[model samples]
Target: MSVMTISEALHEALRGEMLRDPKVFTIGEECGFDGLYGVSTDLEKEFGDKRVIATPISEAGFVGMSVGAAMRGMRPVAELMYIDFIGVCMDQIINQAAKMCYMTGGQVSVPMVLRLPMGSGRRNAGQHSQNLESLLTHIPGLKIVAPITPCDAKGMLTAAIRDDDPVVMLEHKLCYNIRGEVPDGDYTVPFGKAAVRREGTDVTLIGWSRQVLNALEAAEILEKEGISAEVVDIRSLVPLDFDTIAASVSKTGRAVVAQECVNRGGYGGEISAQISENLFGALKAPVVRIGAKNIVPPFAHTLEDAFFPNTADIAAAVRKMMREEGSACG
Candidate 1:
């Protein structure tokens, strides 16, 4: 066992995987140097320049190259510096990497991992701070995982690299430095399994990545007000564990889904719909969704705080849901 931040855990996972597998290699801007968030630092020194390849500042070109490399049996971990840059490589990701295997009748697999650092709270403005996991989830043939804990950040990356499919790792910028316990050595947390951070009977708080941390904090606040809120860390979105969400929502009789993205047409809408459709009979009230304000994220620190949803927003949503449904706060 080891105490590690999410950044360190990811670095350890990549290092461990590269040591274990000959096909594994990483490529991205500055990855061969110190990486965008320090997760890939010191790797080039250990692996050499060829394996820890750095590319030109071209998202489309490098990502296309990575897809071609994956098709040729090389396991590449390609990092797109920001989630906001996805638009520049949409064709390479959505059309080529995602559709190649199915279009070829399972004859080929793009066994690559795309590490995209996302979310706000860093005052990166609208261009660099957008949360687009909701948009990515809509695409087919892509596996998306957003692990909040250092353990999952490490374990799931291992699993993503090993899986014979293209996986998109939605790593939040704010979560990189948060410390947590991580199992030492090689380990993989299976995708589609949601972790229950806290057990409660009143309502379920479902979130992924850094939003899970917000949910946990909200649960603590809700507890003080006599409301028991279960915190469900949705580890992955592509192979979503709707069953686990259903179980929690069923037990609690209510649910509140959250996302760091804007409220309009965000991923929370999909989760809320799923619960309403499958667990409709068990639901005591309509599932509430908490999301950032439907507007471009502001650059100012205070405006950014107001633009995004926080722990208070989550707790208040839960309170509103219970109150409107005539349910007890406790």
Candidate 2:
């Protein structure tokens, strides 16, 4: 095991995968030597221009090109500087890359990974700080994986790169500097597997990416308040681990789904609805959802703080769920 930041772990994973597989290559903006946020740092020097290719500031062009490369047998890891800019390449991502395999009747597979740096807390303003994972998650052919820790960051990246279909790996910008223990060598955390971060019986808190950290902190706060909160990290949104969530909700009886995205039309709604449908009888109260405000992320620090869901928001949601009187079964 090695203690490393999420950035370092992701860099190592990219390097290891490129070294292991000749087909694996990376193409993105400002990803040559310095890399954006240091996730792809020094990769260009090691792999040279062909493998560590850098593209111009055209998201649509580069993403489309990467899709073609993927269809032609190269496993390209295309980095979108910020997930907010996905609108620029929506055609390529939604129509081409995501639909190629299904459109071709499984004759051709788009084995590519789109790395998106997402979330708020960095005060990157409205355009750069949006958590747009829900948009991609709604698409049918794309597999979405959001890692909250260094271990999952590395493992899931490796898994996404090797996946036969198009995978969208959402990297929370706030998680870049956070340090955690990661394995020394190659490993993969299978998709649809939710990690139980904390054990409790009073309520279940479901979160992904950086929101998982907030959920963990909320769990600690709830612990002190005589409420046991079970925290579950839904690592992959596309291949969601409904079983794990259902099991946890069954044990806890109450649930709160949290995310950094806005509350309306957010991925949390999907999870909460699924819990209601599958485990309604097991629930003691309705599933609560905590997320950012519907407005664009604010540039001001205080507004930004209030915009995104935090530990306080999660704790409050859990408390509210616990305070509910009638059981869902009743």
Candidate 3:
């Protein structure tokens, strides 16, 4: 019940975990001194170089080291700076960390966490900004968790660290400063569970990361217009809580899945498809998706604004769904 920025909450979570567990250690580029966004600023001073190790600008090598270290009982958390850089270490993440358990017949556990800053609202251009959670989610045995609020960030991160499987924690670039109440004591939000941020009977809006914030704003606007929009923040994408999403859509009869990722082959597509398959009879209209136009995020602020889905776009989508529902009933 304490108000804190998302960054502070996450930092608190890391700090608490490191204190509670001796094996937990974090490694990344500039995460020690630079701390990039300052989430890991005081970490180096408190934990020292042995625990908060900074590495060269080599994703592949460091990621491999993390996996190797995790196999030897170290809870190594590797930060990739931006998610786009994951491509450089795909072999480590995909062939190694992900399949280690199966390859070793459950004798080995890759208890490692890969933290990456993601999303495209900061004009970080095409390479720096991108929601590639869906890509990571595609790989089996890799647990993907993306938290939108301070509470979930702390809770989910703690859970990810304790998990025996490889976890890819994607932190939204724009959600770092979002303020929310976080519990004082230790807490853990289970993975594969979706939390309904706001409930409504008219329509369901599914989003993650910064899009969840955008969806909430749109929900407020829709509420004023008599469109009760339910907002669902998907904390985990891999072990998806589609049941909760389906339940919400069942009651609402309409859905608008949104994300900062591009339209084609995005995670929204998976949700929409699953909902249509499971809740086909209950759906009043086809599930609609609001996302970045299928183009690389531009560097210019205006172009970026035009590319990413905003509150206005979400409101319009909800309005359209409402209109369609009304037409169908009449």
Would you list the rank order by lDDT, best first? 1, 2, 3
Model 3 worst lDDT window (10 residues): 32-41
Each candidate structure's count of clashing pairs = 0, 0, 0
Tens digits of per-residue lDDT for model 2, 103-145: 8999999999999998887889989999998898899999999
Ranking by TM-score: 1, 2, 3
> Please, what are the lDDT tens digits per residue for candidate 3 over residues 74-165?
99888888999999999999999999999999999999999999887778998998888878878998999899889998998899889999
Q: After superposition, how far is residue 281 of candidate 3 from its true place, in Å?
A: 0.4
- The C-alpha RMSD of each candidate to the native structure, in angstroms, is 1.6, 1.7, 1.3
Q: For each candidate, give its TM-score against the true structure.
A: 0.98, 0.97, 0.97
Which runs of model 2 end up more than 4 angstroms from their true locations?
326-330
The whole-model lDDT of each prediction reads 0.92, 0.90, 0.89
For candidate 2, what's the RMSD? 1.7
- Candidate 1: regions farther than 4 A off: 327-330
Best by TM-score: 1
- lDDT (tens digit, per residue) of candidate 1 on 162-247: 99999999999988999999998888999988899999999999998888888999999889999998999888898999989999
Considering only N, C-alpha and C atoms within 3 Å, which residue pairs clash in candidate 1?
A: none
